[model samples]
Target: PLGQLPVLEIDGGKFPQSLAIARYLARQLKLGGKNDLESLKCDVIVDTMQEL
Candidate 1:
């Protein structure tokens, strides 16, 4: 089941999936790490959560 919406604001955009929104924020904040490896790790974790 889908989770509740997060009570956060963005630059004139709203994202339904909290995890996706988090990833976007991470990228924007430069906390997403340096290279493909970091991105892949993030993707894997998100995928794993979805699979659960």
Candidate 2:
């Protein structure tokens, strides 16, 4: 969707972008981190990787 690569088609919905998909899975699987800071770090790394 929205011309983004690696779209995730799940539960009859189309979610776009790798980061979006990863975050969804992380929340569902309890792997986003133990607290807000940890989660922010994970997000920063993922976003930086995407930028790279």
Candidate 3:
């Protein structure tokens, strides 16, 4: 399915991929970790969660 549902449209451009799109929006809205260590932990959780 090339035309996916979870697409991120920014500045007149479009980006796809589920996890990537989620991460981009999370970073944009400052909804993720607060520091390097926390960010790493968050990334691990996200990666593992995506696998499931």
Winner by TM-score: 2
Clashes in predicted model 1: 0
Could you estimate the TM-score for every candidate?
A: 0.59, 0.78, 0.74
Which ranking of candidates, highest TM-score first? 2, 3, 1
lDDT of 1 by residue, 1-52 (tens): 2445763456675557767776887898887768999988887887787788
Better of 1 and 3 by lDDT: 3
lDDT of 3 by residue, 1-52 (tens): 3788777788888788878986787788786679888778878878998899
What is the lDDT, from 0 to 100, of the residue 34 in candidate 2? 95
Q: Rank all candidate structures by their lDDT, best first, as comma-separated numbers.
A: 2, 3, 1
lDDT (tens digit, per residue) of candidate 2 on 21-40 = 88888888998889999999
Model 3: ten consecutive residues of lowest lDDT: 1-10
Residue 6's lDDT within candidate 1 is: 66
Clashes of 2: 0
